[model samples]
Target: MVTFLAIFTAFLIGFLITPVLILVLKRLNLIDAPGGRKIHNGFIPSMGGISFVVGAIISVLTWFSMSQLIEIRFLLTAFGLMFLLGLRDDMVDISAWQKIGGQLIAACIVVVFGDIRFSSMYGFLGIYEIPDAVSYGISIFTIIALTNSFNLIDGLDGLAGSVSVVTFLFLGWWFMQAGMIGFSMFAFILVGGVISFLVFNWHPAKIFMGDTGSLSLGFALAVMTILFVDSNGNMNDYEGWKFSAPIASGIALLIIPIYDTCRIFTKRTMKGKSPLAADKSHIHHFMMRMGLRHDQVTITIVLINSFFIGMMFIGSNLNDHVLIPIIAVMAVILGLRLDVITLSRVKKIHRETPPILSLRERKKKASKPNVNKEILEKVNLTQN
Candidate 1:
């Protein structure tokens, strides 16, 4: 019930706060023009996620306590870095390398202070053991990759926030179920802010998250992910928190970004292009090619992300090692197949449509193409 209220509050407050947020962002000179790969026609504020973050802080603090707040230094650090970086990018241009540097710093902060990382699996790999050194290396790499995945998925308006809010809500429930209270409340606060921000971001957005909102949300996920495994990792020296498959659970929580980022990088590498190169190759871009409007595409992808995360959450409960492996394999296969199918369609459209078609699609056809040629010749003669 409390969770539902939080969700509802996100929608209600986010809806209300958006306009004010937009005005404030504009007033502060944080505007995004719909140029480059962006298809919008006018200037829109790109820092509304800042407002969402603020609103989330307000909501969570109101419902949760300061005690919980003090314990999450890692989360705070990650969010702070994201917010600053996002804000910096929102206002002025920042190099991709600079953002990457910040993400590394944020990940280190979480790993060192927040103590979030995976140590070992419950037994999916038939090895219930892990080395401390290996764990640190793997966990750090995972955190940085996941953080950037969030940014990569932030290509469409409202899409990033909606996916994030849903992901956090699920993780919050999971954390609470796993007996991690501080992190759960922390998740709720961030969830609230993103949800609220999405109210205006639904479609024809007055503002976009830009890198500011998206990066912060992704970093927040990294924090929860660490907490999700902390009990099994470094939180205690007990057998109470043992997972046969931490990697599986962690991957499920972050299925969308992790998968999407890998796919993007692989394709970019194949094309002799920089992996970080931005083009219309994302899943949402395919959604557009599939003739989905912006709102429809955003909603569809958000729902798909929710579905994958939901499946991961449910699949995590099965104690059968065989069942977990089978489920994981099948899920990944289906996900990859769908990605390939979608990308094929996008690539087809790219091949078929001339670059000039964009203006052609938008232009008003004069008098319906004059289809009646013979009558048209007479009409033309009359006109002449």
Candidate 2:
């Protein structure tokens, strides 16, 4: 099928280009160094997002005709702008406001020109249809929030990429079954690239996708999510593929990042700090400090995400009012439990370990040299 071919083509391109991209990044010395809040060891080539983005775009153009492209032209334009914004930030750090301004511009293009704004709330809050102005405002906020939420979760090896792979795989399959070829192809192509990128981005990662990958990916996801909600709203239960709880299902698909973002932002605001202030208070950070390895944490989060999505399918017959409440309550309870466990365990660990011994152990580990074997292998692969 064309969808499978699109995925394979993108994967092959991404797989081939990533090693070469790594070599270029290393030569250019565009690498992410360890220290600060970052946990990786040694220098790792960054902006590796170029490989996957390029692969996905090329695959898209190859499989989808220009006439078909016109249907989503504005969305693709916004996607390009987002990719460029992130590429710029990864190369030269941009201010938070500047990055947000770019994201706003991209979101506006999608909402205003692409006409993909949400028209209804699906009666979750005893509200159904909304005013056009209100719908535009909500849609823009959703895009910006979703984009940043995803970008913030790219803190560990394979974390963002794995989550993205799952999100797109499900979205693409759903679209395909719904007979939306454009969205289906779009999702499938990106999945190919992300899956390929994961090879080099796994534990002991040779390359990081950097802001370029995360921002573009986040933007693409936001678009797909809106389309998913809007499309499903236009369909009825008799259609078989139509979900009775579109909004709730959408939340389940992206619950981890969205919930983590909300939790972290609330904590920062309560402490009188800027919401965007970088801190190790993210859920992944807590899991890591609780002694989980990078791969372990990534897999754990992925499985949790999978569980939520699976539940959405099983409860697809439920209305938004019932499904949304259940999802919200479950998320709140799980989040609170994580906070309790992390705080108590972290305090207990600190009490047990002497400060001097901890400092000495950290210093001993920092003094050692590390050249990631994965990077070395990729470098060699590119050369030969």
Candidate 3:
């Protein structure tokens, strides 16, 4: 009941705050312009993330105690830093390195002050406990990787928000079953914010989450993922919430973003281009090119993500060593097939379209209107 109220409060706050934020952003002339590689039309406000941030923070502070506040002070501080960084990026574009540096700083805060580093590998690859240095390194890398993965998957309307809702809901349910009310509260609070934002960010979007939302959301998910792994690794006798392969389950839950990022990076590197260079090669873009509208693409991706989550549940009894490899292989195969299918479809489209004339040919053809008219008359007479 308390959990439901928390989610509702956050939702209501987000619902009420978004329109005002949109209006303010419009008045300030802070909007994302559509052109070249962008899918949206016209100028839409890009700071809708601020509403979710405000809503989630207000709900968290209202429900959590001072002790709980202290426990998560560093995480909150990191979130604030990420939000500010994203706002700055949205307002004035920042260099990729600058954004990465900010992410690194936020990740370090959580790892150091929050003490949320991964301490064990949960017996994957025949490794159980790792060195402290190694743990910190892995934790920092995982945080930054997952953070950017979420950012990269935020291309289409409602894709990021919808994917996030599914992830948090799954995590929230697991946390509740594990009797981890605090983490569950955090998950549902975030869910509420993202869900409310989705109302304005659906197809034919009036507002985009922009960097403000993506960065903050990425940071939050990264933190939650680390916590989820850490908590599950330590749980031995938890009846309703024990996983034989927590890391595999986490990977399954985030397969879409993780796999998509890897696919894009690999393709970019192979083409001798910077991985950060933006292009219309994202999975969502390919799906759109295959004739799926924005809403259809979003729904399809969400359902795919849910399917992976279900697979994880069904395979929960499997060993980590066995399950991780299967998931990885499946992801790679799926990505390869998507690329192949998209290319095939693109070729089919080109074949179906009329051939284009060169400039010289077009000019020469235009100069001979009498011959073209005669040909057209003959064709019309034949049709008659």
lDDT of each: 0.71, 0.91, 0.88
Q: Give Cα distance to truth, residue 333, candidate 3, Å.
A: 2.2
lDDT of 3 by residue, 95-171 (tens): 88998899999999999878888989888888889999998899999999998889888888999999999999998
Query: Which residue pairs does candidate 3 place in steric collision?
Result: none
User: What TM-score number comes out for model 2?
Assistant: 0.90
Q: Identify the runs in model 1 with alpha carbons over 4 angstroms from their true place.
A: 1-17, 27-29, 60-63, 230-244, 317-332, 335-384
Candidate 3 regions off by >4 Å?
355-384
Worst 10 residues of 2 by lDDT: 233-242
Q: Which structure among the candidates has the greatest lDDT? A: 2
| Deviation in Å, model 3, residue 374 alpha carbon | 19
Alpha carbon deviation, residue 326, candidate 1 (Å): 4.4
Give the TM-score (vs. native) of candidate 1: 0.80
**TM-score, one value per model:** 0.80, 0.90, 0.90
- CA shift of 321, model 3, Å: 0.9
Q: What is the lDDT of candidate 2?
A: 0.91
State the lDDT of candidate 2 residue by residue for 1-384, as single tens digits: 878898999999999999999999999999999999898999998998999999988998888877668877888899999999999999999998999999999999999989998888877777888999999999999999999999999999999999999999998888888877787888889999999999999998999999999999999998889989888876766654877888998899899889999999999999999998998889899888776789999998999889899888899889898898889898899889977887888788878887997889999999988889999999999999
> Which model, 1 or 2, shows the larger TM-score?
2
